[model samples]
Target chain A: MKTETKAVDIDRDKGDFAYPEVHVRDAGRGLSEKTIHYISDVKEDPDWVREFRLRGLKTFLEKPLPTHWASKDLEAIDFDKIRYYLSPGTGAKRSWEEVPDDIKRTFERLGIPEQERKFLAGVEAQFDSEAVYSNIKKAVGEQGVIFVGSTEGLKNHPEIFRKWFGKVIPIGDNKFSALNSAVFSGGSFIYVPPGVKVKHPLQAYFRINAESFGQFERTLIIADEGSEVTYMEGCTAPKFETVALHSAVVELVALKGAKLQYITVQNWSSNVFNLVTKRGLAHEDAEIKWIDCNIGSRLTMKYPGVVLKGRKSRGEVLSIALANNGQHQDTGAKMIHAADETTSNIISKSISIGTGRATYRGLVHVPKHLKHCKNNTECDALLINATSRTDTYPAITVRGTGNSVQHEASVSQVSAEQIFYMQQRGLTEAQAMSLSVNGFVNDLVRQFPMEYSVELKRLIELEMEGSVG
Target chain B: MNELRVENLHVAIGDQQIVRGLSLAVPRGEVHAVMGPNGSGKSTLAKVMAGHPDYHVTKGKITMDSEDLLALEPDDRARKGLFLAFQYPSEVPGVTIANFLRAALQSRLPEGEEMEATEYYAKLYEKMELLGMDRSFTSRAVNEGFSGGEKKRTEILQLAMLEPKYAVLDETDSGLDIDALKTVAHGVNSLRGSKIGILLITHYQRILNYIVPDHVHVMVQGRIVRSGGKELALELEERGYDWARAGADEPVLTR
Candidate 1:
């Protein structure tokens, strides 16, 4: 791992944007009341949203930085130096051909269009801070499934967006959440009507092209009664010398008898700080699941949470985190059982290579009055080198008398004997090590959708190269 | 000679000498059985020949087809036609038997060349049928949750798939029942031909009954004390290892 900071000045006009003649309009550097108002004016948000942003900004300014957890990396981020909002000087295009040439080139490289044609029912591509393109299949749109940008949803579908926005995860949920609420921009807003099931997944692609940028996307998904939907999002950024910050707030509401699954696969550059706050609310007999995969970043702290608010609801979180050299991945899940007969399960797997560090911080709570609320949490960590590190801190409060809870954790290293065994069978040492690491997380990887699961396996193989001496 | 030859082999694990000045040679088309008591260093000799990192070769020359076998890595040695069927095979979780064997075979190919999946699976099914293994075993993790008999069968399956020029079976029959013993012995016997050499290391003579050897050698204290024909095995089984241990006490250290 190269610890020295490179001298490369991030040229936003270089490899990502080949058309240097294309102008990118931006609500320039720094975060303050002025920047927030400028973003609101650019998007033409309603008065309530502008006020909401101002209040969020005030709350963010007052809240102190977290001192106890992942503080070192958090302190490295200079809030004043980040570019809060940026646009390619192009509005969201409904047709692929209508998108600008340079922006289209970037998504084409990311295979967004190819993926949308295959398994995704809808696609929304966000470059920097604004969504450049969004489109849903005609049949899916006819099914009363609304998929658009958060800004568009607020302006076009106010009745549907205003009722549930910030109801699950409020603006002041955390410092980063408040920060996201203040400078929030281009993220997906999805709503499935009653009894409507979206057969295919809706995907969002987020790319940070500029240097010293902060991408604060606010996503809200609402599944009405007896509805079901799956949404997946992926993000990446080019390697730059300076730091980039990504703080997003995602709120999900699964109404009575509804089922919703939210998946995220984040592979940011090594100079990015990815801190996110995500939470879901499940009503009676509803189900909410979070499937998350984190592969690369300088530092990341994200724990998708679920609040089972009504009777007999269920929640699940299946996550995989891998931290290569010069990276730290802090991720886990939170489940709150507020009603009787609710259940939740969390399975987290982490891998640390070279000098990387992975930390699993989880919270599972079943109150005293909530009878028959069950929970299970499992965490497994694999260390690839002597310097690799991992930590597990699980806080479980099980006060219910009739509920059953099970927790299991294990930390293990790849045994040299196993490597020799594989080598004796003719596999090289690197292949053997990667094989074992894949096996370590195979069960969890099997749960991911086929498109991302295959990619995740290939990514693991890439990271495992030269991992062993 | 087209064979595996060990001349004046002296190996040690840490400070304790194991294979002390041992010399043996098994030419192609022949099966040699090494029978000895516990702690006689028979298994150590097999490991040393396979280049186990823990067992240091203090002084020895191991040659396969007159090539320096000691100068290569274990995987390279395997690619160069060397195989070791462990007495206790390690479990590789999450790595299916099919993938493990495919990788092992893939290593032998030139770079940028891919093994044909259809041909590989067809050959795997044939070998599995020969060993009486269920076809479903290929998809299961390699040797994980396998019974003793199943582990032995998988070992032989790999041996059949790899088709190495020389193989060292270190106590392959240690934990097999009679039926399993017959199946494993049949699997090994099918591989016996003029192109390959086999060395069977065992503490008991029971396995020799199923797969008869061309010659028999009694080892004690890391050196061969007696060498004879197949009838010697029967004599040792009847009289026990006390004869070999008594002969071993005379200190036959000369190569």
Candidate 2:
């Protein structure tokens, strides 16, 4: 029997639309001390936040480029040529009417507000660097849940904000995290009160409307004791001849007996370099899951991690990545068993089409002292074209005597016989190919909410067009 | 007259000929059983009819109702009403039987015309019931982890749903028990009518007891050695294929 009441289920937003440029303030083509301070001053940060930004900038400069893996693609991004910050000058709009005409049209075309009105508990839409609109249902708000932009959350609820800020994933966690810390402007900050469960998902839509620019949003989600919440995010950028950089840092905290599920569907354009760091800390008997899907990007390097901090905590990561022509998706999961009797699971599926390459790099660790800790990891790859490529590197460390870790990985080509079988059932060759590729990722796709599942299927079908001649 | 006719069909896999100078014809409303020993190319003939890319038809003429079947792609042949129940059905992981059947049925409709989901599901359930399949089976992946009997039953279910004008069932009874064989044969028999023609290929004569073919042909060395009524299956069952092989192999002086 399939249970639909899980904490990490799926949902979706529809439509494909973008608006023309309107940049009121552009932190012009460069990353320097001045650019960092410029972003800080524009946001009117407190003394400590400003100092934190400068320190992050220092660390980002000192940290060398990632030389181990994905280095060749990393060299393609020109940091000096990227604009650090951009905004349309309009602040967060409380009403749909309050939003600018062009930006409102863009969101309308993307069907953001319609989805919010239909099912989302709350929505925060970030166009460039700042969220242009934010809203939460009154009933959910009355339940003492707070959903707002990170900047606003810092200003309004500093006590709650400062307690966990940079705590789960501190600065210097990685080079991209450092860069995000230095210039992060807009993302969601959500806090669900103790014992309250938010039924519908809280979504954040990240849109990169400007070319040759970067959007670094920071998200922090904290579920109080015994509370539950699901947060889903989607991202897209317009196609550009030059590279656009999107590097984000997300920190999630699940207190004692709490549960949180974070989902991301990133469909950036082929010229976008998406490097992100997302991690969660789970307390006693708490559960944290990251359901991630990466469909588009020139090169993406992200591995959502979970640290099981207390006894009997549970962590999971379900990931699906598709790499098309001229794309490389390097994604996986990391689980750290810090307490005894904890459990973790990681399932990653990827598809590489027509010269595209996909790599699964995962890490699972159980320290020597933790007893009865268990982990299961499965990574499967489907190569659509003969020239398509895939690689897997799973680094598992088990030190304790009572720990059990099972890791399985396989790479398979879409069998010609299977396609022929489907084709013999009256489907065209392209239809057969799409069905096979969709089947390759269907197990993970089912974990999504019904609407998102349908949309994901459609997106896959569109991507599969012309994959075969 | 709807008929699938093959005239001196010669098929090869690479340089090795698998089906050499085989000729057969199945007209509408008729059931033809081809009983052959191992490697006599019964399965190869079925695959060749399905346009399997592995098999190269060196010289042959296959026409369905005067349309050249060999020139069409596999899917086009299927859409034009040719079905092949594979001896070993491929396992399609993660694609549900319901979805797979829907895609097949949907492809037969005109472009931009959607299949009525309620009507489609109703028909699917009716066919599954005819095949003695549980309703839950529709949600399972197509042939993934299915038992031998279940796989064969699912193939019959597809044949009923497709209602193809011509179906070549290759070794559909190979791995089934008596009860499963009865169920599969009943499903195939239920679809029997004047609009459909079935070519049942098998090594054993057991399934013929249930399906009761209209005619039986003894195949040896990729050619039809003998043709007779349904009683011929019983004759082959009593006297092994060696008699037919020896009778058909008397060297003819073609020069």
Candidate 3:
């Protein structure tokens, strides 16, 4: 989580346009390179960042979206119609006090500050396309904890940012990553110095406000030897008739004996397409954990990956996603074992309501020379409506004779007797359905932070309400 | 107006009849016991009475205080005035008892009427105390990871809190130890008053030792063969149900 001031300076050309009335929120729309240039110019970004945006714009235009592995529904995305950027108040706020009240109220309603007070050591709140306020406890900062948004870190902390940027996840890894790296605006940058263990958690909140616009943020974290840090991100997008795009890239580095845990709860409205790339590199004796919960989206495609590069490294990914009508949640994990005695565990769970669908696509591979490496993968899905569908695709290739891999997958639905028991206890049909769905994904839900888990449950319940007759 | 009445009850599982030509009534403020051995349609009767969809009530009408219950859905029947404590409660994981009960109680409120938090907790605590439940029990999942005895006690706790006009304790004493039987009995006894009626269904009369019934009925196959006062349970316990099944060949007409 980043707590540095967001330098708020809007270019005179963009700032000269008066704050349009609320009625104009729905007036104008469309996607163009002008919109991209406008965003880069407004943020006063460096030349490299501007060039990155243009390159991403060119790639996005030339590349035909890969539809072979996704739903035909995703093909409905009209690239030319979506307004790619909308700056939140004139510019990003540099201090906590500089944030506007309306933006703060949204965070308050989402219980961001309360979460920071109760469970986290540091917190950052992002409104629209930029960070509005960021704060870290003095003690954490005193421990040489370098936490800031990716852009700020790139500008001020070159020694830390320059060495690792795009090294773990390169520009051409995927179309979305290229897009995110090119136009990325606001996400956390956390670097923990060697031999220092931070006992508390850090958090970042991402909220999307503009209709038909895209939010592309970049996040990077590097944990040095013998240190530990946990970072969490939560995002919410307003419900709109047209689809919004949220493409982000997150890169993590775990040095020898270091540990990093990244947690995310994405509850975007069903009108948003959430396609993101997140990966980590773990050196000798290090560990990285990914805990993610995906609740609402028109379609989501994310597979957080971990590459174990040195001896005795460990990694685990725990994910839970719930899909309802007009939604397709495609999510899983990737684990690569390159060093001896490395181990990884992956558990993914999903619930499909109405006619929604959930798919799990995962991979695990160990080279023949990587002796004594092990991996285990498990995927379980629960379907509520009879029309709901689930698919599991696991590709595990183990060449090493001493390596071991185990995989398990199951798909089931709620039984009539279970529903009857809940109803007989005085719950309505909808309440019974919600209880069962919540129970289905419980094991993974417990791994989330308390604040995030509560909000996740409420979102699941709200989505499960109208799916039953 | 204070009674659960069944008239010419006929229920079937698919095309085969399980409960045929049976009628029984228990007035409010009293505990009535119905004893039948296994495979005698005991559990099926309980399920059908609760409006479980698997069993079709081909020719029957159930009512609570002159209000038609057969027309209501299972949950609707519960909120309206009827409660069926299951023989095997479903294990609901990840749903704390507090939240589950809150949702149940919430359904009983008028539209747009929210429950007061303090009042809800105070009432819940009062019910838990009456049932000899620990405070931490409120946080545990509903019947998940619970012992047989704890599950039964939890059911009684629910009965106490919901305060239904009629409660069907289906084999509540089946899996309980003596101590659990006594505790569950105490909870049920505390709620037995003129405003409520109880129908205790079980395979054994040991539970009758703790919750002495005002009336006892002998059920065989699918029909109630006899009805008598509390002494009948002691007699049946001593002589066995085979005698009652044998007497079905003769008619003992006593008013």
Candidate 4:
């Protein structure tokens, strides 16, 4: 029998409260060269970094929204009305006691400190446009592991940070990536030295506490040869009348014989548009894995990709998405095999409830010269109501000899008979619905860390409440 | 009034009348066997009694120990001590038997009170052992890829674990081999006690040789035409359901 923990008290409105904005720096609403310059000046960006921002801003203005195949919701994002940047100016604190009271209380309410104390090797708490508190455990620091805010990493470890910065995902990769590169402020930067495997995960929590604002954080992690690390990040935003935009760019690099696992659990409120660009590069004999769970967003478009650049490297993506009423989750994965003898796997499961919609778009490619490459993709969608919707589009191209690729997709509905069966066994309608949903994603959930899996289950249960009569 | 009683019951599925003016009572500490032919609505009666949403009770009253069962939701009715063993149990993929039973039992507890894990596992293992199920059976998905006999055994396993005040077993022996049927019957028979009532519905009297109900009722179309002691099952077995259908044209008020 499974050990039952007390039901996590995740009230539906737990993340609905916000504090008054107290910022020493606020680049007024709208995006332009002047806004990028203001953000660069306030953040004390170096000359080259400033130039990079200018180039990124130019690219952002040139690229258009990907409306050709994407949802028409892309037309709803009004960049001119969103505040590009806002920072408290107090910089990151090394101690929870030193954090500003208002910001500290927000993280406390989110249980960040307790989580850090329990199992995390380090923790970074970012509010709005900057990291308010960042600290790594002394034991981990002694092992030469560097975990810090992205700005600090750029200043202190330019040798490593600059080498991989915007390398995995270029500045002009997409409109959102370019937008994030232009005004990015707060996200984690992590590095593990050669042959040093971190025993515990490092975590980052991003909170949006302002209205009509856009949060653009840049995160980059590099694992040296023969090293291993796992990093997890979570995001949440309070409900707002006006739309909030969260556009982030995350790049990961795994050198030869190294291993890296990155996980993200995003719980944006109903009025947030979460468009993010995340990708990783794996060297010879290295491995990269992405575990993602998305819920509680108005619309989200993210497809974390992995480029296998070295022979015998491996890449895997396991994702779960749930779309409640008026929400759309368009998420998937991409694997580009650039070397021979590489393998990649992608498994995605999505659920749609009420008028919610979920779509899975995936891509897998193996060039003609890449021999002995393999890829397997599986996408499954579950619809909870008559009005719910789901779709899948997988593009696979394999052109080399001795290479193999397979794709499978399915759509299912939670039948009335199934609900009645569970109900007759004493589960309430909502409870039965949650149980069925959890069951649908059980295999993928088993791949997450214990704490995250528990939290994911609670979030799903909270979303299922009030969804049934 | 320690009994499950259906009075002048009429149930339908979207304009298709399935159970018409049927009435029966199974009191605590007794088992009532319902014998019927194909399309006689035996399964509909069981589903309706357990509050399946598709079957609408246009005119009826279902009560357990003087409490109105129809007023409650299916889950509430189950917690209020009613159970139904489906003829074709649904395959709840990825939900283990252990977890499903735990949720069922957990729903019965007062809010904020949790079932102790040790005591629960001990009880669960004891029930599985009584049903001749291996310990690992708890980890398999509920009824997914289960053999015909395994499904029936699972139903009995749930019945034993929940310990409901009343149960309606619908065609519990339809696809079981003799050995599997005997094992399942043994599991059900062990749970017979003073605090529980059971309504066992079956097409064949063969299961009666094992479960041996205290009362037997012959139903035709939608109503019971005859009621008697255990010997009624044998008489019908000898004469076939054609004997019962001969009188179905006229309603017999056996109550």
Q: Residues A37-155, candidate 3: write the lDDT tens digits.
A: 77777777777767767877677666667787666776887766765555433222244444334334434544554433211111122233233223353557789988776667888
* Candidates in descending lDDT order: 4, 2, 1, 3
Candidate 4 residue B201 C-alpha distance from true site, Å: 0.4
**TM-score values for chain B across all models:** 0.97, 0.97, 0.95, 0.98
1 or 3, which is superior by TM-score? Answer: 1
| Maximum-TM-score candidate | 4
In terms of lDDT, model 3 sits at 0.78
Candidate 3 clashing pairs, residues 3+ apart or interchain: A6-A94
Question: How does each model score on lDDT?
Answer: 0.82, 0.83, 0.78, 0.84
- Alpha-carbon DockQ of candidate 3: 0.63
DockQ of each: 0.73, 0.81, 0.63, 0.81
lDDT computed for candidate 4: 0.84
Poorest lDDT segment (10 consecutive residues) of candidate 4 chain A: A117-126
Tell me each candidate's TM-score: 0.90, 0.90, 0.82, 0.91
Model 1 misplacement above 4 A: A1-23, A89-136, A206-214, A235-243, B249-255
Highest-lDDT candidate: 4
Clashing residue pair totals per candidate (backbone < 3 A): 0, 2, 1, 0
State candidate 2's DockQ.
Answer: 0.81
Put down candidate 2 lDDT per residue, B1-255, tens digits, no spaces: 478898888989988988878888899899999999999999999988988989999997888987999999999999999999989999888999999999999999999799999998899999999889999999999999999999999999999999899999999999999999999999999899899999999999999999999988888888888888899999989899988888676421110
lDDT of 3 at A444: 82
- For model 2, what is the error of residue B147's alpha carbon versus the real structure, in angstroms, after optimal superposition? 1.2
Chain A vs native chain A, TM-score per candidate: 0.85, 0.85, 0.81, 0.86
